[model samples]
Target chain A: MGQTNNDERTPTLLDDMFSVANKRDQAALARLFDHFVPRIRAFCLTAQPGSNLMADDIAQEVLIRIWNKAHTYNPESASLNTWVFTIARNARIDYLRKNGRYQTGIDPDFLWADDEDENADPFREAQQKRDQDTIRASLKQLPSDQRQVLAKVYLEGKTHKETSEELNIPLGTIKSRVRLALNKLTVIIRR
Target chain B: MIRYHPSIELLTEYSSGSLSLAKAVAVSAHLEHCKECRTQAHKLELVGAELFSDPAIPTSDQQLNQLKTNLLSKITNGEIESSFDKYGQAAPSVRMSKLQSGRPLSSESKYQIPKSLRQLIPSFYDDLKWMSLSPAVKIATLSNEKDGTQVALTRIKAGAFIPSHTHTGDEFTLVLEGAFSDESGVYKKGDFISRDARHKHKPVVTKDAECICLTVTEAPIEFTGWFTRLLNPILRKHHPSTS
Candidate 1:
């Protein structure tokens, strides 16, 4: 039933939804809730796994922010999707910072699924493809070893101890390598 | 002093909610004064959305509705107030009482700088040596105020030139009253300007009014020419900013 690709349709739908959401329109906000809550949950699960945070809780936080800050959204400065995701990301970070026990372990599954089947849900497929593209383009500038470590440590949700065991390196070395990797990744992502 | 770049990546992390608390507090203070970094942070937030999209989205509609109910109740009940207050968002305007508590005993109304900047100054204000630049521009040595730091209050006579000088250390100004302008921008009452070592500029007050500002300087001002050097001693010895 969807004609245009998600990159085009998702943003337009979100923009309308956001504009209505900005006006405090309940239905528009509901539509937005339907669309974004799941996206936030899935992303949080991938970005942070087994940290004991419920995806539903994070999704709720993201949605509440969407409602509260809807009026502050300026399309001239940021796209609708960017605005929404930024809200979600901030909600997650705030939650982790307050809780202090939330671990930011990256999942290895994120790396191995690049070549996975298209038949498995096109929306999820497209979203993963886009994130992979972003991670690859940004991380491509980093040294391979650093990228490898970050992908596993941050994106793959692996612990320093587990990564050290898997990579056949000492735990301290793994920590330093991951730190260096994050620094490099930060520079790239910022650029 | 580290440059307050508010780099896109840092902003992205901040907007995405992953930044550490201490660093976030520092960055929030910087954001208050820096327009360029704020814009950059907003842009990075856009980029972050594309970075987090997922294939098979989780968290269902019912759950989101339930969460919405809880959050609405929480907001109505003031749970969000504490979180907002922590980031200095609850109150952007500084209160007189709050300002007084931040500063040491000053007979005049206590000029409250932000907590981070206050830490840069020593507890004592009377220890700094005073110097003059012009009848209106006076500099004080803040060594006693805090580690070789200096404070000055420049009084720009109506239509006077503040003579060109290069900065060797950090310079801070809070316009207590009046107004002045340089190449970078115009500063009026309560507007603060912070110049790094690289900044070189001269300010001129308008003909209608005198400009009086409270300044905290971390380094010496390097006079640019022979004439300025000649005037330096007179200006330095006769500063009107003595406490």
Candidate 2:
């Protein structure tokens, strides 16, 4: 795996964020914002059809939430992305609904990643760095065709039908690509 | 053990954050029980996060650094957004305290309700005003802000059949207590069945005890049987209130 300092730092970043956030550490909060903001902004832009301005606003709100709701995050029920994105997706839906801009309908996509159910690690300060690196490496390893389909479907907020029409591929092909991509991801992640 | 689960397509939509609010709520409720699906959704979410971290998305360092400064200033100024206020709307938060009421009846002790489902309604025990549309069938509805996401706590007496109908859109049924089955298959507690327009069957509770379900419909059902059609008006009326 291509190791970046960001990747190395992120392994414990969530736990570090939680610990320092619970202490109301402003500097740690800033560090977290610097790290997660771009990715979250990207998420908002892709998951919802919003401008850079709107995505920034949403990212700001989501970061503020990470500070406020840090206590409520039970790391056992879900991983960092699951916990954070659940809040982000809900915030976006409610945000869009409040603005009367919720044209996309109630597509239930709360950002989640690997369920650690058999082992709910609420307090484990393990290799979140490795978790992220493995995930990124796994993603880097995916075939472009599979990766593109998965991206179009998940990130671009296109439904399978829409993805098929957009990519000019068969619906079955799209589904399989998604399955194969995820299945491979599961292997790499759990490895 | 969960015998039925939502399809990978639905799971994909769910983890990808493409499912609508109501359908998402239904799936969340199911995930509370089925650990396997929880793991699956979790994996898909990781996939989503990986895609989000793409270096190619082009969020500028200057723009991001500026945002970081702004965020810290906001926090330092004590403008930190509460989870309640993050969405920027004065939406009603579901009261969890209300759901902790006294037990409803025989089934209350029999099955563990998912916190996701429990948090949605005030009291699954007492708040469930199961209105009997017939002798053995009863349903109490909760309103959703979005249309067609009819959230209802439906109870069918042992050996009774749910309304025989064809779905106009997707329908999510999470069995809360006892067991029910149709031509498709048998569904017990924690078994989540997502049926689309192509699916048409009457769920019958063959277990000795009544079966309770948390159901979310993407659209109103078009009942096939003349008997169930009598519920068309009543059902239509209930849909408006159940959000």
Candidate 3:
């Protein structure tokens, strides 16, 4: 878990995001770019190794979206990291869909919209912060096997079935590993 | 009040952007009606965010600087392409209504098609080209994925019974309007029902109103009754799998 640098840098990144949104500050945008672009590129490369051209295009597209959709970002509902991560993910999906990989008419924009809950108050905000911290700390404690599956699914953009095949494990094992990982992270709330 | 939901693993995939678009559309429809699931999904996204922000993989400084310069120049040139402009003005507000409302829109003066499916269903579900399967059942295809998955809307007449059928593969049905009941239990608006090949039952719509459902079928379902069996060839032909 690369927590130390992020934990220190996140506050400034949040401020930079606010400046970009409220003042359209290019300086702040540049700062945000210097921070997130490499990470976004890395995320794309993880999913499509050796596809640097696609990576560059998606990374640039994601930064532009951040510049455009900054006003819509709500820190109460999501961290800046989470917000930017979603934008990057959607951009990657959009790129793949348009490049004839997915070949479906379904738009990724509608499938993943910001769930702006009207009832977001300080209590929930505090609860969300706690959840984020818990996930960060608990993620480190997860066994490597479970963590590998999670990384495959989240970073590599592999479905469970794909992960199963890639890892030479049964589909049931992949599902259970995911379940066990989420359980450790307390991400699954029993209904 | 929504009960049935996508399993946590499915929600995780949806949040991580790993689920196929067709199945993700079904989950999105369910989220429009289930705040609990929405909250769950949001939590899973936090996990994705944490993983996504893992220490940056280094890139060559020259390449990074070039991309940044290009992006900044574009911004200075006012060349940003706003998603709102491209996708239509209604996109953002549609997302608002979808997240804010938990109850099914069936009670409204008009049925509000879920925003996820609005790409296929423009104004009204009635506008789609519907083909009658029988006197009581009709279906309009929304999309056919390359992998043989079929996304369609099934409109069952009021108080009518669909012939008993078993799926050839997995089937996901989300009730869009009214209610329907099979041997298992009654399903109302916003309820997601997943049936595999093992399930074979007759569903009867409530007598009050016609029931409309958004169904994603992995393969064409097979009817069990002797008379309805004749329709299998037609169904297989229409399905992306056999076609």
Against the reference, the lDDT scores of all candidates come to 0.52, 0.67, 0.84
What would the per-residue lDDT of candidate 2 be over residues B46-137, giving only the tens digit for each residue? 66666665656443467577767777788667766554352323122333333345433553543555555544553444456678878988
Superposing all C-alpha atoms, what RMSD in Å does each candidate have to the true structure? 13.9, 5.1, 4.3
For candidate 2, give the lDDT of residue A51. 73
Per-model chain B TM-scores are 0.43, 0.81, 0.86
Candidate 3: pairs in clash: none
Write the residue-wise lDDT of candidate 1 on A1-191 in tens digits.
22235557556666655666455666566666666766777666766675435566666666566566666555444445665665555455556545553332211111111111222455644544454344435555767776566545433335555668989998778767755655543423333
Error of 2 at B178 (Å): 1.4
Candidate 2 at residue A59, lDDT? 83
- Model 2: CA > 4 A from native: A4-25, A48-50, A66-87, A101-118, A121-134, A161-171, A187-191, B56-60, B64-66, B83-113, B129-131, B144-147, B226-230, B233-243
Per-candidate TM-score against the hidden true structure: 0.45, 0.78, 0.91
- DockQ, each predicted model: 0.13, 0.35, 0.61
Interface RMSD values for the candidates, listed in order? 11.7, 5.3, 2.5
Residue range A113-159, candidate 3, lDDT tens digits = 74454566778777987888889889889999999999999999999
CA error at residue A46 for candidate 3, angstroms: 1.0
Fnat, model by model in order, equals: 0.22, 0.37, 0.69
Q: Model 2: what TM-score? A: 0.78
**Model 2: per-residue Cα lDDT at residue A139:** 82
